[model samples]
Target: MATPSAIGIVVSDMKKALAFYRLLGLEIPEPAEGEDHVGITLPGGMQLMWDTEELIKSFDPDWTRPIGTRVGLGFECTSPAEVNALHAQAIAAGYESHKDPWDAFWDQRYAQLRDPDGTVVDLFAATP
Candidate 1:
């Protein structure tokens, strides 16, 4: 059997990437700021890792960044209000907004934003 253990992201700027995830409530350590590779275990024991472009190239010399929306991560907020609040917070911190919070036809208050490396991040909560 195959088990998924971790999700890894290759980022161009480790500092900015860490700050973005921190805003979403991930407790990345301060000392990881300058490292080429950083990993943090999530609440459920799943690890989230970040590696610099240079670090990835060191092992896979032929590696090239993917084009357009290679990764999408969805975060479930406690409520619709939290979804809106988080979108605003990310924008205010200089991250890019892909879509404003809206009541989606699928019954969720959904919003989207791009992380420092342009990865699509979604914030959603059930709407009453």
Candidate 2:
């Protein structure tokens, strides 16, 4: 039987991204001294490896440069307040909001933001 493994997000600045995730309450494992990458363990043993261009380009010949895009990652929360709080935090951190936090007909409070690198991040909090 085949199973899904871990997911990796390539980052230009590992330290900054690690700190951002840490702000979201994800436990970032200690980086090996002087290492360019960091490992974070997600629930269910999923490992997210933050890799640098030098590392990824080592494997691919056509490796260009790292670029953040409008396309973003999504996260789920427990309550609308949590979503609103995260939106506020992201905005306060200089992220531009694509959508203000509001309840959706789909039964969640949802909002969007652009990360430091311009990656769009969507946060949704489920309703009771």
Candidate 3:
């Protein structure tokens, strides 16, 4: 069986990428500037890896971002309040807001934002 271990994200700015994930509770260390890649395993045991654009271009010289949201990622917040809080923090820090926090029909509090590279990041929590 092939077990899923990690997700790879190619980013334009490593610093901003790290900061965004850090704000989401990932304790990523600050690497010396311009490191090719960095990663952190999540609480659920899934590793999230970041590769700088330069690193990707090193191998795939023709690599380009897919049109539209290439990949969607969701983080499970501890509570609805936490979801709202993180959403606001990301927005205030100038991240793009795709959706404001709200109670969804699926019974979860949810919000969405775009990372520095414009990846859709979702914040969600089950309704109490």
Q: How many collisions per candidate?
A: 0, 0, 0
Clashes of 3: 0
RMSD of 3: 13.4
lDDT of each candidate versus the true structure: 0.77, 0.68, 0.76
Candidate 1 residues lying further than 4 Å off, grouped into runs, are 70-128
Candidate 2 lDDT, 8-82, residue by residue in tens: 577777777778888999888767765665776678875566776666565445656645531236676667888
Report the C-alpha lDDT of model 1 over 58-122, residue by residue, as the tens digit: 74477578675334466777889989998999999999997788887669888878889877677
Off-target runs (Cα >4 Å) in candidate 3 are 70-128
* TM-scores for the candidates: 0.52, 0.47, 0.51
Cα lDDT of candidate 1 equals: 0.77
Name the better of 2 and 3 by lDDT.
3
